[model samples]
Target: MIRSYRLLSLLVLALFALEPLQAQLMNKGTIKFEVTDVQTNNPDMQQMIGSMKGMAQTLQFDGAQQQMTVDMMGGLMRINTFWTGANSTVETYMDMMGQKIKTIMSNEDVEKMRKESEAMIKSEDIKYDKSVTKKILGKDCYKAYYETDANGQKFSMEMYVTEDIKVPNSFLQNLNQIELKGTPLMWIMDAGMMKMTFMATDISKDLGSDFFKKPEGAYQEMSMEQLKQMGMGGQIGF
Candidate 1:
């Protein structure tokens, strides 16, 4: 009887461990969003457009936990973003002008970015306002208004989340068709007076540790102004 009880307990524990692993395997896939410039007037704005052809991205999620790693690039810009959870932490590394800059952020940075995006969407202060629900690309979304104090800039923004569509391989697939609900993985805003959209794409289940590795070439870091003078600052705009 003792041996039988011990075996039963072990089986239960194994099953418990397998549950999360199964969920992760089921959720493992790729997502992609296309980034495009819809508004173009200022030369600086035109130069910052993600891609007339649209940008592509890939992300991987670990089902056992609310963690994900994203790989994205547009033209000369590249970035790797990691998120532990919705309100936990986010880290990003941006490659610009042959140099990489890393940003380790807390929930505060995420909230700040959220507020700024909300302001751009509403052309007003979003701090005290509640977000409204809407539909984008056939997926339910939440939206809010926001405005910028810098140069008195104004923008319209929209955010979306979805969970319906599932793919087998997220790294190679395009995310334009995935049906998801209540996922805060998309952001649309105006940068330098240009309307731009960022879509999550090419999600993966197995992201190697090296996916976040820095480049191998030797690089000379430069300040924003110096990079601009060298015509390499545009890489930082996306």
Candidate 2:
């Protein structure tokens, strides 16, 4: 009886310890963000890219999987991108007008795409300064500065990332080949033609059960090459 009681007490204590760890885990949640500003160096494109401001983007993650959603045209068009760290695969689904298209990228495909993007970046090194910190959504975020060289033209950019929220990888960073750590809360990029800024607005742990559900209805799945061949290469985010 005494041995069993001791074992039960240890088990209870272990459970109590796990509660704190679980509370600290911000893995399963959504970080809501809005495109605060879009500046264009070109006077002609100012009216065009300016419309991009006030757009919404959400980052949802659970375990090793993260999904990003971009809503445009008041939901007339939507882009859903999923990254599975377990297999290093990326899947993108686009719903625009009446078209339902999807693209699945394997680990090799993602690596190839990342390499192509990394080539545009002159250096693979990133400078993350922990001393420069700020709070976003009440979470502390550190500063990271990096530059990219595209066709001999260089553009400087920086990101604010917080370790308080854990994610397998940052999707925007993956796409642009920015090697910043933790979850990015603020991203300021200068694309030469335009300067776009994205900042997190809300953080929530209430993703609910339908968070992982894929879009309903038929989706024509195609490879990356097929998508490019369709004259939609630059339109979609790989």
Candidate 3:
């Protein structure tokens, strides 16, 4: 009887050990941001900050599927991201404003981008070691500096990450209509600004597959230059 009891206890312990792993597998969350211009404070400039539907922006992560979807400008940017121990892969896509562009990269691609961006850093070397003080969402934030060299020009980059907020299921919760505070992923280039910020409203997780599908019917496929001539270049993916 003691041996049987020990076996049962072992089974229970095994189940307990697997619980955390299971939770990690199912971990998912959504992050939303309210976009505003720190310099101009003009609400209209906020629209030009990046592609977003009004002032609302959102990003959703599904840990189990290793996928994330960023919703902006009434369009979905799906990214297939997988992290293994320390390595990762991210595939980005945009289907909005009558345009579609997909970029897929593995850990190697990340390293390549890092190397290419080294020249843009203020240090002259590939190393980045500068931090800026800022306030986000009423909380203090440390903004890291980086640089990217594109088209023979160097551009400064700033990013912010926080450790204060922790939610078990951020995606499943109601996030919309909440004034969240956080610095978003932003990249400003010569052509325009590229940013990813959270929305102030929570959307139903029941987003249909069609939300990511491209629109049918006849549509004009214009080159970037052509779109610029037609004054629709910025409206499409930038």
The lDDT of each candidate is 0.39, 0.64, 0.33
Candidate of highest TM-score: 2
Name the top lDDT candidate: 2
Error of 1 at 78 (Å): 1.1
TM-score, one value per model = 0.46, 0.79, 0.39
What is the clash count for each candidate, in the order shown?
34, 0, 15
After TM-score superposition, the amount by which residue 119's alpha carbon in candidate 3 deviates from its true location, in angstroms, is: 3.6
lDDT of 2 by residue, 160-231 (tens): 878787665555532345444566789887768768788999999867566656788899888868866765
Off by over 4 Å in 1: 1-28, 50-53, 64-75, 106-152, 163-181, 184-187, 199-238
Task: Give the per-residue lDDT digits (tens) of candidate 3, residues 9-53.
Answer: 221111100000112221344544444432324565453443332
How would you encode candidate 1's per-residue C-alpha lDDT over 1-238 as one tens digit per residue?
3222222222111110000110112354445465543566776434333233364455544432222232233334454555554344545544543455554556664355445434323312332122566454555445533334556645344555444433222221111122223344466565455555666544444545444344444444433355346443232321
Which residue pairs clash in candidate 2? none
Local error of candidate 2 at 185, Å? 0.1
Return whichever of 1 and 3 wins on TM-score: 1
Worst 10 residues of 1 by lDDT: 14-23
Worst 10 residues of 3 by lDDT: 13-22
